[model samples]
Target: MPRIGVLIDNNTLDDHLAREHGLSLVILLDSGDRWLWDTGQSGIFFDNARAMGIDLAQLSGLALSHGHYDHTGGLDRLWRETDFTGPIYGHPAVMTGRYACSCCSPPRAIGLRTVNRQRLASQLIPVSDTARLGPGLTMVTNITRQAGNFEPIQGFYLDPLGRTTDTIPDDTALVLETGYGPVLILGCCHSGLENTCDHIAVNLGINRFHALIGGLHLKSAKPNHIEETLQTITRFGFSEVYAGHCTGTHAISSLSDALPGKIHPMGSGLLLTFPPSGHSTT
Candidate 1:
């Protein structure tokens, strides 16, 4: 198993810590294998990485959890700053036109960040089903719907315009396999946490996961959804859970109470080491 390190660079919180938009994560694997899960909204990315001591230029590639601005905003800086010749991964819709809606109101076409899009195509290695990133490293492509009361991720709406239809399927995630066990990483998890877990379990043909890092997409989850999610997670029996991003504070607290020590706080500059022996100063 290899060591996995994650940095939550962007978020939905405002200046006073209020929810608004979202972002992605920067995950680093052992053997100097590095990846950007999602770039984040823009201004804060590079600085955030520096503050966290993450060198994006050294990253092997950049991955988009989805096509939202908050997730892809940092691509411009990355393309401008580094000679990084690594592949970026994501669904094709990430480059296509999309929209953001408000209370089922008129659709506001999501403004395309052309520069970033171009950089992604030139640099990205778009994946659909599944692909081996590096040794023992794989990205999941199967999307499934499990029988349970847990609600899927919500509030994401697409518009059915001229050539575009409401297509949010571009939402995806990343999974890393370590020496200890497989660690599931997510961006927004617009798919579903259970789906993500189940897919990984089936694809890898292994049930036990050492840890689950990244967003569980529980911020908007209903009570039943939360309860079912917790139950499902308990069944998987992950040793540690480092979650945040789209996961609300209230939900995190509740999960913390339910699981006690198993829950770990995830933020912009947090590092988690594997084998339970690597020293983490932060």
Candidate 2:
């Protein structure tokens, strides 16, 4: 069996826990393998983890989904606090400068901090292709763009001046082979969920996904874009979906209306358990 715990998120299960505009997940496998996926925008992850009684030093590995500051900001704190010496998996571009400029706000640095990059230099494992973490877990890198309708956010740039377009190629997902099917653990889904699913189907021969947990990065999407994304998600037929972080309230509501009980609102302190093969819930 495998269990997932929401260590940090934009919302909290209760008022006592602190909330943040970021995401982080802790995965515990039946074999005692523990993996930390992404670290939230600040030390809030550690705060929430302490409240939840999760020990950061027990992590067997660390994985970053993209270069966004919201995803990798806690790296400095993690390094300073935890004694875990495991490899940190991510794309090479994750440490590069990234910015976001919208009509509403000025260009802001949204990439990983240099200090954290230096701290994680020795343990960083840049994966250009699919990298196997364990027997049933794999890190997907450089997801190909297969869905033409899905577009990256318009205001992102690779340069501080917001001149060079940032495709966010480093956005990745972790796939876990479960008894039911493949479960996708995403950071922000900047490459588009449809594209990520297609890449997995084509490269890994996985057609159905049992569950999808993490941000979709659709907070500022247009109505048509949201509709198209929802339609594509419906076509894939995921059994369970816990979406939050960059997934706006409107989109989450729409998904809940469309999928009924299949959709769940993800937040800090939430936990999900999946039993091993042939193990009944009863």
Candidate 3:
């Protein structure tokens, strides 16, 4: 059996667990290798991991989903708290400057924050294209925008001056093939879910996805927008969507109404297990 522990997220299943406006998953494979997918906006993820009985020190590796501060903020804690010396996988543009701008306001820095740049750079493994991490596990990046991916990744800039739009080329996802079926894991999902799924289908030749686990970046979207996203995602055959973090309550409600028994809200301290039978949450 494979296990996925929600180290931290926008909410916590219990009051004892810490909550944050970010996402992090502790992936434990059947082969006994432990992998970390993203690291919330602070060291709180580390504390939550310990509370959830996860051993981060023996991690096989760490894969970043994007360059956002919410995704990479806990990285400094990784170097300071754990003895983990494994390679960090992400796009080469993960270190590039990123900013968030608004009407009549300055662009705020929202990229990766670190304590030791040299050490982090030394352990970085940039993924310009799709790559397999282990048996039945793959990291996908550089999503194609064709096939009517209208979900806009707006309000972001490549520089503080907002001269150029930041398309977030570093946005990536992970695909894991389990005994039950394929699971697609995301972080923020700035590339748009439809585009990411389309890219996977075209490049990997894997048409349908069984599960979708992570943020949809639809926290502030209107009801109609969430409905449209759900309509497009159904094409991928996802039975369960563990939406969390940036996926707002309104979106969850819309998902529940649209998919009935298929919607699952993610929070810190929640554990998702995949046995030969299927997937379950606890």
Candidate 4:
């Protein structure tokens, strides 16, 4: 069986745990290979992990879905706190500068911090294509961008002035092979959920995805876009969908309504376990 623990997210399941606008998940494989996905926006992940009784020092490897600050902010603290000496998988462009400017607000840095960048250089394992983390665990990088309507969000830039549009090429997802099917672990899904799934199906030769657990990044999408996304997801025949973080309330509600019992609410402190070759048990 494989167990997934939500260490940090936008919401908390317990009153004692702290909530933040970020996401992080700890994956425990049946083979005893533990992997840490993303780190959230700050040291809050560490605090939440402590409350959840998770030991960071036991991690076998680390992987980042993207370079967004909200996803990589705790890297510095994690480096300082643990003696983990494992490869950190991510795209090469993850260390570049990135910003968000919206509604006349000044551009704010949204990419990984400079300090963490320097710290991670030695351990970082850049994944330009598909890379196997271990048995049944793979990192899918550079998702095919074929969805014409699934454009990148506006006001995001690689430059401070917001002149150059940031396409978020570093966006990636972790695919876990289970007995039921493949489970997708995403960060923000900036590459469009449909597009990401399509890449897994066509390029990676994965026919069906058993579950989708993580951010969808549909916060600012229009109603029609959400509907279209739901329609696309329906084709994947996923048995379970646990969404949080950048997936806004409206999008989650819409998906829940459309998918019925398949959509599960996700937050910090949530624990989900899946049998080696069967359905997941919450």
Q: Model 3 over residues 106-156: C-alpha lDDT tens digits?
A: 779999888777787999999988877755678998888764464556889
Cα deviation of 123 in candidate 3 (Å)?
Answer: 0.6
How does model 4 score by TM-score?
0.95
Report the error of model 1 at residue 249, Å. Answer: 1.7
What overall lDDT, based on C-alpha atoms, would model 3 receive against the true structure? 0.84
Model 2, span 29-110: residue lDDT tens: 7778888898999868888888888888888889899888888888888878885578999898888788998777888988
Q: Evaluate all candidate structures by whole-model CA lDDT and list the values in order.
A: 0.64, 0.83, 0.84, 0.86
Model 3 misplaced stretches (Cα beyond 4 Å): 222-224, 276-282
Q: How close is candidate 1 to the true structure, as a TM-score?
A: 0.83
Q: Which is the better candidate, 1 or 3, if ranked by lDDT?
A: 3
Q: Please give the distance, in angstroms, between residue 237's alpha carbon in candidate 1 and its true position after superposition.
A: 0.9
Give the TM-scores of the predictions, in the order they appear: 0.83, 0.94, 0.94, 0.95
Candidates 1 and 4 compared by lDDT, better number: 4
RMSD of each: 4.8, 3.1, 3.2, 2.8
Model 4 over residues 157-201: C-alpha lDDT tens digits?
999888899999999998887877788899999888888888888
Best by lDDT: 4
**What shift in Å separates residue 112 of candidate 2 from its native position after superposition?**
0.6
Stretches of candidate 2 exceeding 4 Å from the true structure: 277-282
